[model samples]
Target: MKKTFDLVFFLLLFALVTACSPTKFATEMAIDALTGAGSSTAFTGESDPELAAQSLPFALKMYEALLVDHPDHPALLSAAGEGFVSYANAFCQLPASMESSWEKQRHMLQRAASLYLRGRDYALRALETRHDGCIRLLNEKRYDEALENCSKEDVSDLYWAAAGWFGAISAEGFNMRRMAEAPTAYALLVRALSLDEGFNYGALHELAIAVLPALPEAMRYRPNVAPADDPVRTWEADYYHGLGIDPISDPYRAAYHHFERSLKLGEEGLVSPFVAYAEAVCVPQQDYEGFRAMLEKGLAVDMETRPDSRLVNTLQAEKARWLLAHAEDFFVVIPDEQSEE
Candidate 1:
């Protein structure tokens, strides 16, 4: 009888320990169909752009269900926000088809802007999970409250969130509704720079390079504008120094700086930066060689650091298609008769 009681007690204790173990829970979750391993399988298919594009809405729905269970999950919120932004920009609003119809392009661009704003809202909610209320305040257009909430600790998310907000404003134009939100966006970006100068691997520097020089004199009161001589001098100085020269009136300096930084980061096996650099910087500048170099480097790096980086592979395939389509324009011919003459 004593031996049986001892055995029963040991069995119960073992069962309790196993039930509470985090590793066990994680392993179980990893295989769970609803919220675990199956989700990873979905992500694995993202290597194909067409498949990824098709799967995005499904993936987002899965995330939404997970969020219902784990309502405040930061990763889920970030994924959802980023998905909307990407889908809107990459598929809906691409300006390449503008040659066919400007009206269609304009409508698509408006849709992209709406999606970006939605992304901003979701990102703001994610920030709230970390107790950084700046995101919420920024959305509310309470600049002073937002600035007060912002601190050095929140720099990473703050940088990205502010960039998204500002990009939306820039792309869509600042009406009264957006104008109310502009100050908070400006203050948050300023705080991001103050906290971490190297945030986004100096992508902010490129933004400054692009916007400051061409900043309309009238819009200086809006976010991200400053006197050319402001003491904090981050964006301007980094832009000039990164490019090794100043093109006072040229937006191309920003493009050059961003592309260079992307190349530098991608060589270190950071693939997304390379893709972004190619799309946002190189293509905009019509720097076909630069774009090709960045894309090739991205593919090489993706094979190492992020082997499953679907976006990198997509960018590489796109680059190949682009090169094939524009081979004639990309190659220069020197006629023998002209050379002799």
Candidate 2:
């Protein structure tokens, strides 16, 4: 709940872990590795994104191999769930977000939908591991009922689950069944937002920027997502959030500073901030050159120099390329036709 990945708590937690068996030792190791800045789950340092991307398969298999023996290990479940979400984010969704061709984009979205759902399942496992019977209740469509059993400590896993669910629903396109599932995901996210807007340094807000706006325009600001009572904090939340208000109508005075803060807070070299600003603000305002410049800046970030999020940077840079190529799709150009005759 306090976040910052309290190393002390885990140290004490696993101190009692005798690790009498190899399985137990392995699980303990996985937890430790996750906390490491260089681990696949950690995504920190100047590690090569390509190398990191390549290593993920083995890393996931590492988790799965352990899960076979310790199905209910909370740390393992949390790491694995978060890992899957990151994988989908950096892999499946990146291409989907960038694909200019509708048919290809649809195919990619379908693929992304499955990975996101798998991530959601793992998140649910983590949640249920933490809060008994929560997943079972969730399976029966009792989301709020299930969430009632959660506390502030549950925010990370809740964000993971709802993020995956919402992303899957978003990529899968509009349908009655998917629409029906939205409220549950909505409730989970709102709760997570309330509990920890600082989770991963407003990473949840990155999701919120997309999630809140994806709803019908009229319903964007439901009671659940109302600004906090404290005006300053509410304003701060809105700014760091990727979209940062109506980019179309409002110039978003603090948008640049907001993104700068977001990058400083969590993603220094990550491509997400660049891509987020490009799509959320640039496209809406029809600032083609600005969008291109933002993307170019993201591309220029050296993975070897400041590899905060290599896979994400690489993937999002790819997105920037696609957007540049498809610039006309998002902005209109007035044909300089003359015929004054």
Candidate 3:
């Protein structure tokens, strides 16, 4: 009788434990599987851009569904946020920019902005998991205080959030609310850079190069030019000094510094830095020659060499070609041999 009672007790205890926590165990297992190395490789390793774009929405939705079960899962939140940002850029924003019809372009850009904000929210939530009151601080406009909570481990969240925010700002035109929030996004990016300047091979620098040019003048760094022979002066020092502006800043100097840094970090493997510098820097200056040279350089990058980044490289190459073809639309003065003669 005693032996039988002991066995019954053990069985009852095991059943109670399993019945009470099975859902938790299952959710944990799903999260682990979703975040495993093989999961990301399956997507990044895909060679076909169209196929990847078609399938990505489903994958993003699946991530959202998983987040429903694991609301505070930082990895899931970050992955989902990054997915939305990537989808918005590759599918919506790029296509919109190339759309010929004004109405279609505007509509697509609006949709892209909405998607970017969704991604930004998810990334912010992920940051909240790591630093509980950071979101509250951000809302209160205490941006620096909120960012202080972040550490090196939070760099990915910071980067994705800032990227999405900037994308939304650019996509939505001059919407006051987003424009107001630009400082917060800038703070997030700057904090991420401080924590890890080399993260993702200077992705932060690339982003800075693209967005700094568009920021409001008040938000820019406009320190007085340092002495010509200052031993501690960096490259930006020389650039600003050459511009011959005292107590003034050419936003382009900041953009160019990062442009150079990104190229050095990305080297030959990445194509976007070239395209970004061309569009953001050269086009504005109407330097058609510089623009053509940069796009051609980007086009020459062989995507097959970096199989993991093939999709991005392929997309950027397409953009470079399109920009080259549309060069007439961007420049007011296109020099020809006849004109030179």
Cα lDDT of all candidates, in order? 0.54, 0.65, 0.77
For each candidate, give its TM-score against the true structure: 0.58, 0.70, 0.83
Total backbone clashes of candidate 2, pairs 3 or more residues apart or in separate chains: 0
Quote the positional error of residue 96 for candidate 1 in Å: 6.8
Task: Give RMSD (Å) of candidate 3 vs. truth.
Answer: 9.4
The clash count of every prediction, one per candidate, is 0, 0, 0
The residue ranges of model 1 lying beyond 4 angstroms of the native Cα positions read 1-45, 66-73, 94-107, 131-156, 166-251, 268-306, 316-341
| lDDT (C-alpha) at residue 91 in model 2 | 62
Give the per-residue lDDT digits (tens) of candidate 2, residues 1-341: 12323442354345448644344564565556653444543453324556656766555666666677778877777777777777777667776776668889888788878878887887888888777888777666554467756777888788888888888887888766776777667667766766666777567656655554345422322233434532323433444477455532343433454466557766465677777778876777777778888888878776654444555666667788888778778888623337532
Colliding pairs, model 1: none
lDDT of 1 by residue, 1-341 (tens): 23432443354355468775234454234224333322433443255666666756654564564565566776666666655655655555443222257677667767767777776666666767776665556555444455545565566556556656665775576566664665555555555656665664464554444444434333423445454534223443553564465434454554465556644643454554555555555665666667667666665664445444455445545654454355345345323445677
lDDT of 2: 0.65
Ranking by lDDT: 3, 2, 1
